[model samples]
Target: MGPKGPKVIHVGYTPAHVEQVFFPHAEVVGDLGLSLARLARAG
Candidate 1:
């Protein structure tokens, strides 16, 4: 074991995509959600 570098967290992208997005220097995190949602209130 040795010193570590920056910590990364992926939202919803594949490993390959994540690597590309982070320039192949980031730790990949699992998907967060499947679908997005929006809420509205009546006045």
Candidate 2:
């Protein structure tokens, strides 16, 4: 969706909330990142 590939976005949640829904890759970004990922974006 951007200049690279599909755009990845975060719906605005606390780091804890994001973690509870998804895995963490950067304490917070990990969840948002993986949510939009097509591969192993969490690792």
Best by lDDT: 2
- Residue 14, candidate 1: C-alpha displacement in angstroms: 5.6
lDDT of 1 at 10: 39
lDDT of 1: 0.39
Residue lDDT tens for model 1, 1-43? 1125455533344554633335444433454343222111211
Q: Would you list the clashing residue pairs of candidate 2?
A: 1-6, 1-7, 25-30
- Residue-level lDDT tens digits of model 2 in 1-43: 2245443444333543444345333433355555556344554
Off by over 4 Å in 1: 1-3, 13-16, 20-43
Q: Go through the candidates in order and give each one's C-alpha lDDT.
A: 0.39, 0.43
Cα lDDT for residue 19, candidate 2: 43
- Evaluate residue 25 in candidate 2 and report its C-alpha lDDT on the 0 to 100 scale: 37
